[model samples]
Target: MATGKTDLGNAFEDFKLGQRLAHATPRTVTAGDVALYNALYGPRFSLFSSDEFARGCGLETAPVDPLIAFHLVFGKTVPDISLNAVANLGYAEGRFLAPLHPGDTLSAASEVIGLKENSNGRTGVVYVRTTGVNQRGVAVLSYVRWVMVRKRDPAAAVGEQSVPTLAPAVPAADLAPPPGLDFRKYDFALAGAPHAYEDYAVGEKIDHVDGMVVEEAEAQMATRLWQNTAKVHFNQFERAQDPSGRRLVYGGVVISTAKALSFNGLQNAGLVLAINGGRHVSPYFAGGTVFAWSQVLDKAELGGPGGAIGALRLRLVATVDRPCADFPDKDEAGAYAPGVILDLDYWAAVPKRG
Candidate 1:
């Protein structure tokens, strides 16, 4: 019998700029997925919750949370894109074009858009735009992300660097609400907040008044649940070589947890339409408690068949072991605070309740 050979993952030199890859597996989102997502993230967005609430808002049934579809698509790219990644540096120009429901089958593909070699010979940044599609072949979500990956050979020749210019934020006019989604009959009581799109003002801030302590099991389980195959997050032997001596918590986990915490004051700010940009400013690990807060940067009325609608550009900041009652954020030098781990900018649709 032949000996089993372990599959070593891709290296920085292996990627060609503009190369396209079709990721394996078409995952079918189930009711169980919806339930587990709610448990993991605690999103109280009524559009993804009660069917009665959804119908009242003009949806046929409750739709799956946008982040669920996001994590699923992002997870599918791990093996091909970030298997040998040192860090997922950032994300940009993400747009949720359509809604997905339980039982919808989603598949994804990615095309390398840019590459840059780091000064250190052993690392480089790989930029790719990934698109997710339902079984019908309609694009559901798309985003650009760049990751720092290791080189198998430190002396490998550096390729021509090409970093794609990305939009500072998705234009509010381009942000699409789900087709057939109408929030005119939105129920404030069921949504757990009375705030409407008109209720918020530009330059306003809100403290997300809750926190969750990171746990090793939950972090590992969550990353794995999305089929994320990053070695640093799983292989203890490999991660032990890092200076931190700890497996870094996934940034998406921080996003989800922070988004969940935002529910306290942003209960009606559901339906994430676009991710303008995001940065994992610092690493987070188990044993750290995470808190978050949001600032309203801008707001716009969206023309939708669903009656009055609006989108808000919100800055979500997450910190470790630090509460955000005062909205702890950046400094004069544009540096994050001591405990700040994430700085995310995004647009979300809030109902103009009838």
Candidate 2:
């Protein structure tokens, strides 16, 4: 697996508890980026896709998609955090503090917080808290991600390790919207939903059964936009030399797609409470078709003078290499067979029935 490049193949070996990896790449979020994302996903939010609407809201222009901020930060960790990953376990304490305007530059860094040896002895867990900062040194986004990494040797010199327990779920009250967010005037029509706070049930689950074929151009465009400089995800030369023989799609794209697909059932769920857990079950490549389905896991009540609302915990699954009409299940070993791309769990805010 030597590529005659930097010893990135062994980058996981150098990951130490409390070490930080910072990646700064300059980028001007562009109108083209917004347009393409809207077109591909059918996100009709005028505030994000229309400059006039954004200006009316007292903004200079349409802001970059908030999820794009997550992409920018998590994508920077592939080389150092999860290069030898067996799985991505979960996320905690994710927040978007500021909006990303088009002309602003962004950078990302991660601090290793926890590490553990698997009882199986083949893999270990590495947890890191990642942060995204704008050119002005303002923290725009922050989240914790832990991945199961393969050990170089089963019996390598053992080091003192302490594992951290992740929250089973985050409370709805803990979910914070970005500063200056006033969704009271939220345009539901432009946001692609006609139902307000009156629609939806406690146990209802909607399957957003649409499929999209990821193209080489599209994947590369998104990865570069996030400033994810992963060679395997972008370099055709590297892909040709690798055993996979195909370029890998960035995991963030899959996560975003799953979030978008959750819109069918969780359309009214505007704000994300937390990313409880997630997994990229299989390697997704360009030209593969992606389909998704969502299930409601739990619900919470939130009532105040501003009427009433609820938060729905949801599990979204994305599949590739096959369709998802049957709702496939995982094996005993926790491995998703062929045709599965992702399994994600999260919570979102939905209005409750009066």
Candidate 3:
């Protein structure tokens, strides 16, 4: 079908290896965006929640949560990259390079690094590495994501199969915290967590012990806040053909909600340095309650023995309608529990005891 003037977006067959797409829309971060994000996710990370606390730790003011920046940047790619996508498969090698203040403007661009048609021939996978840059053209965030996209014509022949080899996790040495960041004088009393970097041990599990119900209004509002235009998230008529006959909740919503819920136990580990990898284990819909748990996979000291900051490699899992007291997870064969919806691996900056 010809879209003519209306721009229906690119199909799998329309993409070619090495294609570069400079996505449209540059959005300036704002106080309203920050407030709305906080309202939606209820994140209580002191660094992002209080300007005074941020200044005490050496920032000019509290910065927007890194995930907000991630969502904004990721949302910009949807029109050109995944408007016709069946689903976003996974994310890898994501790094947050800079803090985004309220006034900073963000834009994105992506390079098609790989492509392969599915054996079934109805759809294919597309790999792209996207870079989000601020107004000065400095890259603020970078990540690689693959999506399953529908083909315009099932009979169309795909030229070649190229899959990029991704590192299992970002090396700890490569993680970057903001410049001038010093937790030496960090106020643990005001931060709401007595436990610092020294208190957590590798292999320890922390049940966030909280759950938040996903409401239809808030989920759609969050997707719109990031300017995400994915049809599956909003077009009921388009989704009517599917068995569920409902709009799908955006995966980013689950990530943010689960991260917010983690604050109860991992309050000190607020600043995310890098997302090693993540997967939407299953589809989530509105009206389901989300619960989460975290396990410390690894840890690193950033500056030295006397360094003010450290990093924790964490596995954060979110499950629908299931409390995490039992730590619901994959079995020996790696099958997730029936309620599991998200599994995320990432490195976070935590303040060391000063």
Candidate 4:
């Protein structure tokens, strides 16, 4: 029994530049997966909710939420990449390349892209590009993320640093249109909002008034459902040593919650095309009510065979206990408020219904 220890995880000393890892446990997405996703996040976008609605717009059936694909792929990388992480730093160059349907099996692999040891000699940031592929080996999702990982030994040598220069945004031309997707017949009433691409101007702010308090059990269950192996989120004893002395809420939980709340105003902007960048501004724990808001940063027309498909650049913000009534963001001097827990920039597909 003393000799039977599992692979704990990779520490900073264990990572080699350009190393590759094929994650385990390919998941076959099912209607049950989609249903559980909806139950956890409460996403109300009609395209994901109604098979008939998706067919009316040209697809045969509703695809699972893109965030589901994102989280599933992200969850796969935890054991190999972030199991020993101090924190997940940021994300870049995320794009959903294809629709993920029920019964499609998803597997993931990652390549180490960058590493820089901290000056304190306690931790280092590891950057990796993760690609999610279906059963046929067709890539469905791709993205880059950096995480702060602890060093097994403080005296370990700092390896070659290869911080990657990631793209600031995904180009409009590169946005992948779902197969046979056309929004020409999109119904604003059924989607829950009448705002089309033309209705939202750049710099427009939307306060998602609703707030949901995350309970400790709810957060743990959600993380477990994703199969994330990050120890800090699961081991109460490991979290006791953390500065906060509490199990931190996963950033994805905040994102899904905020995205669900955004339905009050951005019901039509349901499809997440890409993640340009994101930051967990600060660590938040259970028992705080989360509120959210969004700002339209930019917009472009992605014309498809179905006619005009609109893509909007949105900045989503999430705060703990503080409602985003005024679209709370960075202060005039350029610092997020104490309550702000997340700052995310992404592209969403919106139907042009006029």
Candidate 5:
């Protein structure tokens, strides 16, 4: 009998300051794939869920969800970028350059852009620009992420590098909506929200409470849909070559699942303002039950012709190996312990109640 091994066990030490990690494997987008995601998440926009609806918008067929691009690109870097990360600081300059359509395949790569030593000397920070491309080598999605990584040795000689100045928060006006999107014809019932542009407050934290068990089929389907092409995420036959004897669920699934759960409490909020931060603290695999919790961090009012709109900064967390019984718990050292799969900070826009 063959054994399964964890690919991430010793992968962190291999990352260098200026190295680029390119993932091998690509996922083909399909109509069924789009249907499954919409059915599970309840995002009923016609462009993504209906071929007829897409034609009305001047597209030949339904397109993949925009967020799926993030999954494809981010999943590719897990082995080399975040396998041993302590925390994710934030995301900046995220842009969706092109729409992904069914039948297209996608691949991803990342380039390290910055590195810094922590004052504690036991860890350092690494920043990278992750990009996703289609089979024809057309860029689809791109973003910047920074992570806190532990040093292999606490006393390792530090590199002389200057820390980069990160934004305190991404402003609401800076959010990039999908190209050719017209909210005037948006289906409110299908969109799953009745409120718009005026019903939120700043500094309010909402706990999005829901739980789901990731199935093997679902995990493999999602990983493939993003065109992540990571061996650890697929190839159950190959996975048996490792010690665990199982394939791991892509971490981006957990992040997206948690974001979906947040909709119950933050439903009015639209357009992700910024990814203030995120962390995948633990590994998740098939049969693992994932639960989510969220808190409101800050709120802001924006001026627009439709009316006054509100934006809420939020912290969303996902847990595996166990459910979240209490929210926002931290030890003396202020680190998330095991059972926590994700800790994310973001901003969203909501309609005000006039």
Candidate 6:
């Protein structure tokens, strides 16, 4: 008889509703990680790139990019939650509770919240709520994501489905700025934009006016840097069965790329308050040049009506090899235009010029 020693991660049937999972390998974020992340995505947000600029905004030092912290937490769950995933579907109710700085040790945990078998019987959707925390056990980030996973046996029975009800968006009152964060002393010139919170109005739109090509090497490296173990991102042979015969770029990469490009106009919109909802509309492969545009969905006064901080609800859209000059988006009938790859709705904290 052969002994089972090798660990093949969980399949569809392995997940049970309400089961909690403690992910391994805690990572202490460092300045080096910050530097590498900058190199990878080239985000020019002053709050993340310059400590002096961050100090100007009343933070102790430049905090790690919220998306970086998010990716780190999401990556930790891949080995256990999505090793056999067909695709990551969408995200909802994501909120950044605290800022992560260099030297902060980060870890993650998840609870299986929902499960539903697909009609094909070869796959199922798994919904998990994952939380990342610092060494002191304070929750830094929390969100819900669902993924399609392959089943080990097509005939295995999956019991009744249980999908949790999620809010369409995080309430404005729930947006939290980092402790001691006072944007009254914000520097517009140094931050790359002079626009303040009041300059933007609801329903207004802006074209980011930049394009970035997704290189295969950089995409793979960025994914590995987060310790993401998704096979579709790294294994060419496994992806050979597909028509493209190329590995798929992680959706988070597109989000960061589109965000970096947004710096052209929204430079002072540095702090990400919440990711209410997002979707990866299409698969993005290496070599596609990505472009972006944004529309102001709504706005709110954070801290108080006359406080130094405020928030903007923005709908960020990304398209491949297509300029956002025309604002390519879903039509009245509810369908995204061609080349449109990502649709992200989130809230960002910006300074008040007062």
Superior candidate under TM-score, 2 versus 6: 6
Q: Per-residue lDDT for 1-354 in model 5, tens only?
A: 444764532223344566787865676767776667765455433345666655544456656767666766676666667655654555666656677887888788887777877788777788888888998999887778886776777766755464556566566566543454333443445546675544444444455566777777887877666555545566556332236676766667787777666666655453454576666666677777777777777766653433344566777788775666565446779987677777777766554553
Instruction: Give the Cα lDDT of each candidate.
Output: 0.88, 0.67, 0.91, 0.88, 0.64, 0.89
Residues 1-354, model 1: lDDT tens digits: 554685577799989988999998789999998888787777777778888988887788988889999999999999999988988889999999999998899999999999988888888999999999999999999999999999999998866679899999999988988877776777899889899988999999888889988788888888988999898788876642336566877788999999989998999997899999999988888778999989999998896665577888999999999888875487789777799999899999998754
**Each prediction's RMSD to truth:** 1.8, 4.4, 1.6, 1.5, 6.3, 1.7
lDDT tens digits by residue: candidate 4, 117-143? 888999999999999999999999999
lDDT of 2 at 16: 78
lDDT of 3 by residue, 1-354 (tens): 776789788889989999999999999999999999999999999999899999999889997899999999999999998898878889999999998999999999999999989999988999999999999999899999999888989998887679999999999999989888988988998989789889999999999998999898999999999999988889887641236665788899999999999999988888999999999989888888999999999999998435879999999999999898976488888898789999999999998886
Where in model 3 is the C-alpha error above 4 Å? Answer: 240-244, 304-306
- By lDDT rank, best first, the candidates go 3, 6, 4, 1, 2, 5
- Please say which candidate is ahead in TM-score: 1 or 6: 6
Which candidate leads in lDDT?
3
Write the residue-wise lDDT of candidate 6 on 265-348 in tens digits.
Answer: 899896898999999998898888999999999999896334889999999999999899976488888998889989999999
Q: For residue 122, what is the lDDT in candidate 6?
A: 92
Name model 2 segments beyond 4 Å from true.
1-10, 26-28, 39-42, 51-62, 83-90, 117-124, 148-158, 234-244, 264-273, 299-311, 321-326, 330-338, 349-354
Q: All candidates' TM-scores?
A: 0.96, 0.78, 0.97, 0.97, 0.66, 0.97
Cα miss at 240, model 1 (Å)? 7.5
Query: Which residue pairs come into collision in candidate 6?
Result: none
